[model samples]
Target: MEGISTLLSYILPGHSRSVTADYQFLQQSWLPTMHFQASLPRLPVPKLEDTCKKYLTTQKTILSPEEFQQTARNVDEFQLKEGPQLHQKLIEIDAENKHTSYISEPWFDMYLSDRRPLPINFNPYMIFYQEKNAAYNSPLVKATNIVISSARFLRALRAGLLEPQIFHMNKKKSDTKLFRVVTRILPSRIATYGAYLFKAFPLDMSQFENLFGTTRIPEIGKDRITKDPNARHVLVMRRGYFYTFDILNEDGSIRSPHEIASCINSILNDPREPNLCPIGILTTTERNQWAQNRRHLVDIGNADVFRKIDTATFLLILDDDLVSEDFPVLVRHFLHSDGCNRWFDKSFSLIITGKGWSGINFEHSWGDGVAVLRFCQDMKIDVSMRPHFHPEEQAHLPSSSPDVEKLDFKIDDVVMESVNRALKEYKHWTLERLTTKHLLHNIFNKKQCKNAGVSPDAIMQLSFQLALYKLEKRAVATYESCSTSAFKHGRTETVRSFTEQTKALCKAIVERGTSNVNNKEYKKMMIECSKTHAMLTKEAAMGQGFDRHLFMLKRIWQKYYDGEPPAIFKDPAFTKLNENILSTSTLNASVVMGGGFGPVVEHGYGIGYMIDDTDLSIRLAVASYKHNRDASEYIASLISAFEDIERILLSE
Candidate 1:
């Protein structure tokens, strides 16, 4: 009989070859930048608790110091600088987050690739990995949205920061590729169509920095808000219920997106439970046949939608364990309801959060992405009543339990067949397909760069190391990788007045025929480009790094900012990008959540949220690999990040 290696060869014809390819790709392509990978074993994660504590130290300091104090001195009620052209109002509110000119050189390279003359035919590939699958309209839409912010509004925004005394608002630019913003939020379009929103406002920094076009907010200890800085109230909102699956276990359930759904399914569909609803129906526990109702299940009916009484909406494709050492994985990702008045109100809209969470938001038209934080917060609605936290519950954070041993099997025909089968047969596939990622299993990888202090490349490298660790059986978390990136808007630093506030690039995309006034800003950048090119050496960029962008945007890129010295970026002919932070959003983190779920079957919303909602939101992401590697501890880390963020904020 042939040896096991021989059988694997047959199962995976490309086995021996992939090992070389994976190494070459890593060593030549990725490792040169981060030498540790080639020479060392998988990079080590700091003791999860310690690393988390470190990350939390900064989190706790975000609003405590001088910057907060300085800004606190003269607080202005968030005044609408521009009168109500409803969409314009959204733009002004949203634009405040952006920092510089929106045009990102790399993204521009991606966009203008075809149009560019000669050898530079844009690779049409992720500069880091294989070209992202062209199948999903997501990338295209993403490109459009990114450009609107990067190219148009990002370049021309006003400068200055607003420390709102009231809301924890996160505004992002809409992809120019999406339906018109006004049309998107229209109750009509929202009622029957897709989510006009995406994984928008979750304190996502890359997109925020790019649109806002500034350096990371200096630590409060290092900066100041203004005189008599008033301690801003920390505002929390539920976004939506996220999901994951798991396998039944001994110590506890080994949940992933799939298993979570299954658990919710069993409890929700139990006829004895009678009326337990899904995540959205009850922002707070009001009605349920059983006390611990498992909401977030699935309803099999055609045109199935989530609702107040529909506990069967959530579904799980994996099993659960009896005792979990950590948070179980989530196989399924969350989606807002398409149900009648009790869910979305037939109008695509964002739910504005406040002291009293809205009760009427679960209706179909009322949803989009905006309500997730609130919806998620609502899931823990019952927690406040029983507010006391056990040590384990207190350890809660947002993380995952990615299975790591599968790489030993090789990218042989066997694995390919399983993945292919996943695409063709997986009934609940929400993402585009599993083919490309399956191939790049050894290639490009990243994680979101939350701290503005870190370099983007460093962030990507860390994510790469994490992926490697998981592939090599050393990862402590479910995330094989994360999406680490930043946005590049125009620029600015002076917050002299409201007129000096940032502009929303989305405005241009939303309202065609924008005045030439905004057009001037782009022209100015064209002029600056000539000099920017002269001064911007690739090495200098590496030095300025992502963190410096936060500061250079203020000191160096001022020309591109809304009210800076006008001629800095201007040229005689073409209008350069007028970048701004407003007018954009991305789903990289949300996509990560989806990936954690093993497969993404469907997604809803692009830019809006639920109205009259809860204060905190919960997300559940699951991963389904060939086996359930005991992962409770790793999954717990993610929950730890969340709690760390929450606790730090509370203690402050």
Candidate 2:
């Protein structure tokens, strides 16, 4: 019964759900947030032959004929030999572990086993759009409101009062109060069935548990996640100093907003100069090195302070720098910062700039963008609708009970040396190699794509293919993240956007240039490419994609077999297909100004984009080591590609 609902979602495309619209109705739901967990289906594994076929198809667009033939032979041999046995073993293991998805444990191991530093390699940032009212943009006021609103969200979630996250295909019918009332009366086991009857699909809420009071603890080999849900305080960092104070009272109710504001203000105004050796910078170093330094800190009697910082409800960083109007510069700030004021190990840091511009820089090991996006969306709406502090209001002076306490670590010479080394490495790594460029193209957007009868996401992805072709005259392996949250304990799937249709479209555009030799042909190719991309996206979302299945089979071969692995795993095409030269993701929300991450590969580009009514926002980052890559040229190509796409769409 694995992926039954997911398969149905694919079969009945009209019944699929979207999460773009605001979910204010969550505040009015009658059912518990986890009511649909038990009924959610497990992520399914695709058949071995289907996995091999899909693998060959993906390689065809990027590989030469000779290379493709060699790879096909290897794949055929593996499919007939080791692939079946390994896949069968995986299925058996998955059957024994009926409580979770097949990919969950290996996925966790994949992230935890990485020895790279977390900043550019793992952590990503999402910035919120500025408030409409100028007064609400005050740092103190915004920080206060965020604290209060976040506490409300936490309380609702812990008490099972937060509405379960569901995708409603027909909001008018499925997202109504009557639907909720009917669903509340159904048994917990059948709650999902009730939702299906209403054409709403509930998402797995397991990741929500780690959205708060969670921190990644660095170890020698692999990092681990630690959560202290009972802790009531929030950790605050400013000018390289750490502070902790309670935000929730004995009754589990949020404290006075004015009090929270005052404590933050005091820390902001504190005259203590920045620490000469800020310990937070150590987290930006290599994981194994950071782990060794952490052990030293514990040996030096800083364990209690470390525990407090780890167990806090969440971290709030009060940055001294004012927000920049330049989009790329602001992205740089939110993404990694100076490394001194950011504790990159926290589950997520709510950062408020001096001018009140704010966003979240999150550690990516525990979860993906879906959970964080929901938190951001809900927080944005809550603060806008029900603000606790006004712009004209002043923070009330703190009384004897809830004063903020600054945490002081007793560090010796060795720790200071480690901090200095870490700072040097971080500065060299971030400041020297990476470059980011942003584009806000106003020529066309989702509305135009829809009016032209094409998938908006496909249009953007096709533009990427065209852009890369124009720049490099080749099609490379590209990655687009597709969420699989419709299943139990779902994470993500790789949507291989470079397809045979996309390659044809790119070749036609590049070869024809501005001539109208094949205008009708171009339009036909565009539509076909969109349809193919849509099919791939749906398959990836339904847990029927081949990437993860093949990955897990290879993992089993490596872990269980002692001798040399299968030939398919050793093929050069396999390595090239996983290189991911153009790594892309889309998160379009009313409140998100834009967001991005660093390039996964040293010479590749990491693109985060959002489609709006009249424009598209793209943030592109690359590691320009030795000036091998040009961010500006790639951005120009993207703009031209988008214009070319628009011309084809509007062609008669």
Candidate 3:
């Protein structure tokens, strides 16, 4: 009997090697989600001299000649003095710790120690493209699908059946059934070799563990992340009230879609007029003040309720307002809601508005966009392909179905007063201080970029440089995030997009109009700028960038040294470069409509863009404190810059 069973396994359609050749089948089959982690390479530490040279090179593009000279001297002095010792220490630390990257601890520290509120200052948002079928876009239908699909994702992840995330350079060869079968049988220690042989690379999966069942717990000075792997329920918020109900059954199976929808319908239909002392509003307050208020809640016996919230699989927000068709208004709703119905501390909150527009508002400290975006892509695919309920389907449940429990927080006059203050502050912060503008450029996109023999991302970065240079009359420090997830325990590295090559091109276009510009010479310069930007992006992605290395070294100086930082750290140019006046990031996934974050500095702009086959989408946000910085005007400049660059590319 055993022999027959084994023989049948080889002959069955699902288990046959030939059947596995279908990429879709391979994805659905069992593949250890973290099998590649053991063999993933460690992130390298760059040389001290290389870092010093790059630092000076970046400063030269942004500073005046005299300022650049002083900064160069300071960098040279630091290179000769304390730099070597710090670099050596960092190397030794890396050598001793083979399990993680050098930047992991310090990166976590940098995010956790920040005292600003999470909504605008830290948390970022991404909206899902509307569903193709209008029925699936119903609030109840969408919410039910999200819950069901999320549970499937969580279950697959825990059971080790989820496909490992891989980058296939040549999909025709590497993304085949033969490659999957071969890699599956190999031991975890050397499985990556099989992938490398096929020119495929598996990314670090360490961050996936924190994607679910995690919360950013606010403390006085520094917050910490806490997770409960055993939590089977999800926290739900509606009209500023908190509730929880189990989404997973006792046998470890996901609840039926009808049952889940019934539970959500109960919460949505609850007659509780919006909570006057909404506890969630406190999460939007400054971190330290929230910490104090949290302590008071604990002192007054709300610890059990807090525990339920902090340990849930994730949070789902049911918004009472319908989203506006205006792009900027839609962005504002998802980026940071009215601040009353959001618990921004959750690893992420899946928000569904009345009209059924959905997106994610996530806490930034736990992880970067790589993990969150992957989750979003998978959820979107699942919800679209295998939807469990229809638009007009009514939710029905048996009497045995469990009821959702509302979290009744014990509050007093002090807590109510804090809630009032928090509401006022949140409204002022979101409405008055931070503003957003959206641009959808339909002129040209990826095909045009490639036909001109340049990367689409490089073109976008160059457009940003030209736009800012046109608006501000000078180049400022810019940041483009490059994921370092190809290595173990990696987060992100800064790709400084503003280069001398880009600056020169922007100068020519601004000073001499496109009609007067020399097309041949300008095209050569544009290509050179694109090439340079590509090199910077590659270096940053491979963890060989100078920014993280220098950042870590300066942190060591402050923590270990006695009095003041080195001369290089004190330079005005150094401070200005780190300010990141033009912070930019790009996510070009079909599942995402648009995304944005608030400015990093008071007078800066946060730009999130996506480039498709025929158009470009941009979301720009800025703080009101800088009277000179207008998001709308900057967007206008970006549009003009794209037109100017297109002419340079298309010229004979």
Kindly indicate the candidate among 1 and 3 with the higher TM-score.
3
Over all chains combined, what TM-score does candidate 2 have?
A: 0.94
Q: What tens-digit string does per-residue lDDT give for candidate 3 at 1-652?
A: 2443354345434643222212112134445789888988889999899888888888889999999989988998999998998898899878888889999989999999999999878888988877888878888889988888887788767756678989899999999888888998999889887799999999988888888989999899999999998778999999889999988766455665676888888887787788888899999998999999999999999999999999999999998566566667888888887788999999999999887788899998989988999889988787788776667666354333356888889999999999999999888877877778877767656777778888888888999889888987798999999999989889999999889999999998898878734876788898999899999999998887899999989988888778878898888888899998889888756778888788888888888888754235443333323354788788788889989988877875
Candidate 1 or 2, higher TM-score? 2
lDDT of 2 by residue, 345-431 (tens): 999999898777888899988888888888889888888887877877763544323479889888999999999988887887778
| Per-candidate count of clashing residue pairs (backbone under 3 Å) | 194, 0, 0
Question: lDDT of all the models against the reference?
Answer: 0.21, 0.83, 0.83
lDDT of 1 by residue, 236-263 (tens): 1122222222221221211222322223
- Between prediction 1 and prediction 3, the one with superior lDDT is 3
TM-score, per-candidate, Cα-based: 0.20, 0.94, 0.94
Q: Superposing every Cα of model 2 onto the true structure, what RMSD results?
A: 7.2
Error of 3 at 388 (Å): 1.6
